[model samples]
Target: MKSMTSRAMRAIVTVSLGAISTAAFAQADYPTRPIKLIVPFTAGGGVDTVARIVGEELKGVLGQSIVVENLPGASGMRGAETAVRAEPDGYTLLLSSAGEAAVNPHLFKNIKYDPSRDLAPISLVVKVPNVLVVNAASGMNSLDDLIAFTKSNADKASFSSSGVGNPQHLAGELLNRMASVKLTHVPYRGAAQQVTDVLGNNVTATFASYLAVASFVEAGQVKALAVTSSERIPSLPSVPAMAEHPQLKGYDVTNWFGLFAPAGTPGPVVDKLNKAVVQVLSNPVTAKKLADLGSYPSPKQPEEFKSFLATESEKFKNIITTADIKAQ
Candidate 1:
């Protein structure tokens, strides 16, 4: 009986060590198989575009084929959850946006995975800020003027956004809180009508990407008030950042993209992935492509990206709670 028990214990230890050694050898080789890059959006969308472009470049760097798969649903949470549950073998990766990784858990009640816990951060791919624009007819020129208008004419001062829980909606709510003003939110199905209403003076203002309403802005049909980034962007250098105002200091928001793998993936695997991404993002042609879409390629290592995600999660939670943002 004693010999049998001792044999059982040794067998268990040997099996455990074998498994660990196998995993370690697998991690050392890394992408021995084709990698599945999941983009939680429809094809041709911004997130999908990022996935494809970056994946194409990463294939060369990693010497493996990258297959970009779209898994769009549940405002991107479905795909994020899928990636979170994937085997942590570095073969499955998620190209996530702010919506899925930062805001969805706070916005949706039934989120299956906690982004900070389930998704291991590799790098932040890009940052795209929205321009807060008002109808030229409204005569609200700067952030100060807009604040004053919303305070005095709260009923009339309103901002249109694509959806209820999107970044645009949160940006408006942030202004309401920090500036102590109430600009009524007008949610739309998409940004096209939102921009149209702003131009028609049916709505006072809307937060849109500069590229989305660049023609109107250039044509003087819409007035640019401020950008939602921490500092003014070079594309619209003359406009001030939202954080520049005394009342709304530290106000910054943007649609950012990042790369993540499932939690429990080996540290060495994550490090190798990050190195490939850093090299890929520096490609001149790839940088140019992202730049044309108003995206700045910004890469950070695992630790730094982990910190950014934490800060962003906290900030998003505050905005959603204070503004009572909900998903439908």
Candidate 2:
């Protein structure tokens, strides 16, 4: 019996050593092939664009090709679920926005993965502020005018968002709740479509990323009312923030994009990815490009990003619960 027990312990030790050796070898030869950065939205949107730009820089930094794969559906859940289930070898990553990484868990009834536990945050890439814009034909020029109009025509006025349970949608809901108004919601397939519908006057207003509607606003196709940031954006200084409005006492909503790997990724691999991202975001040329698109680099440490995500999750959970937003 003692001999059998000794043999069993020896077998276990050999297996453990083999596993450790395999993991170390895998980590050492990490990125033996191309890495996939899964963008949870379709191509030609802000998230896709950001992924391409950052992927280019990452390639140069990491000496490995970064392939961006667009898998759009279920308001980004399909792609997120894919990444969450991927192996934790640092090769597969999710390039997701605040809606997917922070907001969706709170709104959806049966999310297959939890961002807080199923994934590891590598770094925060950019912070994009959404603006409230109206079609030029609407004649709603300033924040005051729009507020008054919505207040008077609460039942008639409607606002469009990228989708239900999106950050933009939640922003509009926050405004409606705070201002004591009943502005109707119109959900679109994506930000591009939302911008189109707003510019076509199909909806009274839209909460959209500035990148999606900046050209339209500049071309006089749409009128910018207020940004959803705490301060005015440099590119659109004339537009006030919702927080500045007396009716919106503490309104603040901004969209963020970050890189994340599957949970259980080794610390060394996570650090490697985070360092590469920080270098890419810290470059002046990359920063300029992101800023040109109305986004700013937010290169946070991995742990810091993890903590921020936790807080944001709690915040959106409360907002969703209070607003009684149901998933579609």
Candidate 3:
């Protein structure tokens, strides 16, 4: 009986070793087929566009076609859910914005997958800055003017954002917290409308995407008060950074995008993906294209990106908790 038990244990060890060898070999030759890149937003949207740009470059680097699939919905949760549940093979990946990867799970209740646990970070892809703009006709010329206006007219003051619990919304909330002013929050389904309402003076101001407000700002239709970054962006050199304010030096919120694979993916596979992403982002043409969209490439290795995500998650959670902000 002892001999039989010993033989059984040997057999089990042999089988486990065989499986390990097979998986390692597979990971070594990762992407034997086309890789699917999921974008949790509709085609032509910012996320999708960024995914395609990176995907196109990845095709050349990996020597395999990168297929982009849009699975937008549930506030960008659908694609995240699908990606998280996918096989831990390198074939499936997600190019996610800050909302899905860091904010949405906290903003919305009962997310099926925890981003920090269920996704393997590849690299940070891009960072986008929002320009807080008010209608040029509002007679509000600077951040100080806007703060004073909102403080004195709290009952009538309002600000618009792309949606609740996003960077734009939280930026406004951060301003309220540090400045001790109460600006009524107004959510918009579309950014264009956010600008439209601001232009119409239907809302006092908006934390608008640079793309949405660029032409308007150049056209002098909306006043670009300050950008939501630690320093001014090159595209809008004259505009000040939110943190430049003496009392609001801590103000900094940016919408970013990153690449991720399903959790439990092999380390070899993850490393290869991160390398490809970094290479793609470093190309001059790719940088120019992203720059044209008002975004800039900012690449980080898996561990670095993971750390950044953690910091961002905590910041979002603290704001949401303090403001009692929720999505219905």
lDDT of 2 by residue, 93-130 (tens): 99999989899888877889989889999999998899
Q: What TM-score, to 2 decimals, does candidate 1 have?
A: 0.92
Better of 1 and 2 by lDDT: 1
Model 3: per-residue Cα lDDT over 188-298, one tens digit each: 988999999998889999997788899999898999999998889878999999999887988889999999999998899999999988899899999999988888899
Clashing pairs in 1: none
Cα lDDT, all candidates: 0.90, 0.89, 0.91
Top lDDT model: 3
Candidate 2 Cα errors over 4 Å, as ranges: 1-22, 25-29, 137-139
Which 10 residues in a row give candidate 1 its minimum summed lDDT?
208-217
- Candidate 1 residue-wise lDDT at 186: 94
For every candidate, C-alpha RMSD to the true structure in Å = 2.1, 2.4, 1.5
